[model samples]
Every structure is written in C-alpha cells, then in structure tokens.
Target: MNTTINMTGNWKPKLMIIGTLLGAGVGLVTASLLARAAEEGGDLELNGGDLLKTALGVVTTMRSVAALGAGIG
Candidate 1:
C-alpha cells in the first residue's frame, strides 16, 4: 500500500537534479565574480554614510531576490 511516485526508474528525477546543480554552479560563479570585483576595488569606494547605504542596498537586494524565489515577495 505504498503511495509514493516511484522515481527510481525515471529520467525526470535525474534531470531535475542536474538542473539544480547547474543553478548552484551559476550562483557560485556569480559570487566569485562579485568577490573579485570587491577585491579589485572597481570604483565603488564610499565614506561612512555612503558605505552604510551601499551595504544596506546589497543586503536588501539579496533579501528581495531570495524572497522572490521563495514566492514571498
């Protein structure tokens, strides 16, 4: 009386896993790029207030993106 969709003999599950891995790979690459940009100091230097603003903006953007992905935005 098992009531589960048996995915053992399906290619769909494999494809889904591959898709997830690809998305994760892309995100990692993007993070690396952002780190490189920060390290190289590509013209984003700011003072106290400006630095706080920039930090807030980046954090807000990340949160918004996560929210949208979670369908909560």
Candidate 2:
C-alpha cells in the first residue's frame, strides 16, 4: 500500500481564509470610521451622491488591489 499527500494543493484554502479574514478586518475598520464620523458630525443621513462616490472609491481601490501581483515575476 502507498499513500501520498499533496502539500501544494493546500494553499487555496489557506489563501481563501486569509482573504476572508483581511476583508472582514477592513470592513470592521471602515464601519468603525463611519460610526465615529457620524457620531462626531451628528448626521446619520447619507445622500445618493455620497453613496455613489463612496462606491466608486471602493471599486477603484479593489481594482488596484486586484492588480497588485500582475506585474510581479
């Protein structure tokens, strides 16, 4: 009888877990900042323009992050 273990195949789940944790951490920090801003400004209202701008910024940031390793060797 013979058995083999593929160590290289383990990276996918590890990468996924790291990505999930990082994303969650970022989300928590962003939420904390927003909450602090709202509390200090005493304004809980956000208009459409504000939302659109924030969405665009987030998309741009994600694009930049996605391109991180594209030029690496």
- State TM-scores per candidate: 0.45, 0.69
Question: Which 10-residue span in candidate 2 carries the lowest summed lDDT?
Answer: 64-73
Model 2 Cα lDDT, one tens digit per residue, 1-73: 4444355868779878998999899999989999999999998788999999989998988788677635322
Mark the regions of model 2 whose C-alpha exceeds 4 Å error after superposition: 1-7
TM-score of 2: 0.69
Tally clashes: model 2: 0
Say which candidate scores most in lDDT: 2
lDDT of 1 by residue, 1-73 (tens): 4344455777687868976898699779967887888889876444799769867986898799679656686
User: What are the clashing pairs of model 2?
Assistant: none
lDDT of each: 0.74, 0.81
Poorest 10 consecutive residues by lDDT, candidate 1: 1-10
